[model samples]
Target: MLTLNQIKNNPEELIKKLSVRNKDFSQLIHDAIKTDNKRKEIQSSLDATLEQSNKIAKSIGQLFKEGKQAEAGKAKSEAAELKEKAKELTAKLNDAKAELQTILFEIPNIPHPSVPAGKTDADNAEIRAGGTIPKLSKKVPHWELADTYDLIDFELGNKITGAGFPVYKGKGAKLQRALIAFFLDEADKAGFTEIMPPLVINEASGFGTGQLPDKEGQMYQVTEDKLFLIPTAEVPVTNLYRDVILKEDDFPIKMTAYSSCFRREAGSYGKDVRGLNRLHQFDKVEIVQIQHPDKSYETLDEMVAYVESLVQKLELPYRIVRLCGGDLGFTSALTYDFEVYSAGQDKWLEVSSVSNFETFQANRLKLRFKKVGEKQTQPAHTLNGSALALPRIVAALLENNYTEEGIKIPEVLQKFTNFDLIN
Candidate 1:
């Protein structure tokens, strides 16, 4: 949520800045300001009524002590009237405050100044490209490769469960485990503490990460238990510090976790739903950070470089793109998406996204920190990124490294996979 000062002091400037999102929040901003103003006005009136009531009660006591029964009765009556008015003002204040919060919740984080103006992925600016697209005269899609090798059993998975839940068998299962291990080891080497977070989260946890009520439809909810299946490890990992306060020395805190992400893929369509392109259940290694606001952007860049390293180690042809305003996540101030090229599909599949939420999630989480000699605390900045989502990375690996021999495992992952090729 934006600070109230931002809305009241510069709604016009805020509107102009967020125009890149292609939606106007001018009326919402104005309504929030108006609601806040009414809340303040009612609050002031209540304060005055309470103060006067206190003074009148004191006067009644004085009169009673002096045996002035008549005067005491009159002051008591006035105090009763003031108390009634205070009650009405108190109720008005609550309504106004709640109304303002409703409006604030509907607004998304303002984009950073560097964010480009655009409407969709086509508008995203490519930052840089790396690796080389292989020269493949013929390459089959990952689904075909899986079937030919008896690796993943989509039909079996359907018999047991449903679509989007492919069952891995033999080498396919081993490769998935190997990829998870590889990603975890890389994160561990990058100075992040490994965490094993729960797959199910409560409503509070969902809301803390801006998942509830915004992207609610995209999550699998365990309705009877009021728990939501985590869409990403980011939810549980980042909530580790929810409602927590840290000392100045804890400036940079990092955590990494591997989780089986569950998404409804609510309305995924057409070519987008092919094979591993979109899945209800997929594995991902996530990295999260809680940093001092001043150093968050630096941490964001560091995270970007770390993800870049993972893609390079895998030897996949990839590119980094800066997300345009419209494509940015709800809580992120700035985001960069990393796409790996899949030769079989002849498309760029997004395998990771690194973002700096810059206190947006922290504000909702109530995660705060105290400065060295300061008595007051301020919200810490939060950031998270997919170190790499396994499915698409696996897609690119199988597609790009395919040959008559078999799929070639990346040299870095050979030790984990226990073989050079999967035939």
Candidate 2:
């Protein structure tokens, strides 16, 4: 959520930036300004009335102590009228504040100045590409390769649960476990503390990470309990420091977590859902960092480099793209999506997304840090990224490393998988 001061200072500038994301902020921006003005007016009135009531009550008490009964009664009547006015003004102030909060919640984070003005993914700028796409002797999609090698059981997953939930079998299950461990290990080596958070979270946690309201249809909500299954480890990991105030020395707090993410994937259908491209449930290791406002962009670059290193170690063909304004997630000021080449599928599969949310999430979470010698608390910058998501990474591994003899495991993962190849 943006501060009222920020909105007041640059309402037009912010609105123009949000317009790049296709957001219609004219009414919301106007409403927010009006609500904030009304709230301030009501608050001023309530404070004045309360002050007058307190002063009159004190005078009434003094009059009674002096045995001045007639004067005390008049003073008491005046106090009662002031009290009633204060009460009415208080209610109006509360209503205005609530309305202002509603308007603020609807306003999205302003895009980073570097964010390109565009409407879709097609407008995203490619930062760099790495490794070479392997030339397959015989083209075979990951789904076909899974069936041939008895790696994953999509049909069994359907029979047990439903579509979009596939079961990893044999080497595939072991490979998935290996990948999770590998990702956590890689993240830990890069200074991220590993955490295991609850898969279910309350509404505050959801809204704190910007997953509620807008992405309501994308999550699996437990209606009876009013909790939601987390869509990414980012939601829970970032919320760990919610409502917390840290010292300036704690500027960069990094954390990583492995979780089975749940998404409703509503309205998604057809060929796009095939194989590991899209799924209802998928395993992923996410890295989150809380940094000082000044250091956030540098930390973002470091995070992107870290993810790129992991892909390089695995020898996967990948590229980084600076997401266009409209392609960026709602809460992220800037985003870089990493896509791995899938040989058989003849496409680049998105394996990770590293984003710098700046103060947008911290403002919502009330996550702040106090500088040395400073009494005031300021919102910290928050960032998160998928070190790697499993299904598609697994898809890339199988399709890219496919050989006539077997599927050659990436060298870095061989020790974890305990076998060099799945024949």
TM-score of each: 0.94, 0.96
Q: Mind giving the per-residue lDDT tens digits that candidate 2 earns over 1-423? A: 788887889888878878878777978988999999999899988888888888888888898899999999998888888888888998898899888988888888888999988889999999999999998898799999999999999999999999999999999999999999999999999989999999999999998998876788899999999999999999999999999999999878999999999999999998788988899999999999999999999999999999999899999999999999889887889999999999999999999999999999999999999999999999999999999899999999999999999999999999899999999
- Relative to the true structure, candidate 2 reaches a TM of 0.96
Each candidate: what lDDT? 0.91, 0.92
Q: Over the stretch 18-48, how does candidate 1's per-residue lDDT look in tens digits?
A: 7878788888888888899998899898899
Candidate 2 deviant stretches above 4 angstroms: 58-72
lDDT of 1: 0.91
Tell me how far the alpha carbon of residue 167 in candidate 1 is from the true structure, in angstroms, after superposition.
0.9
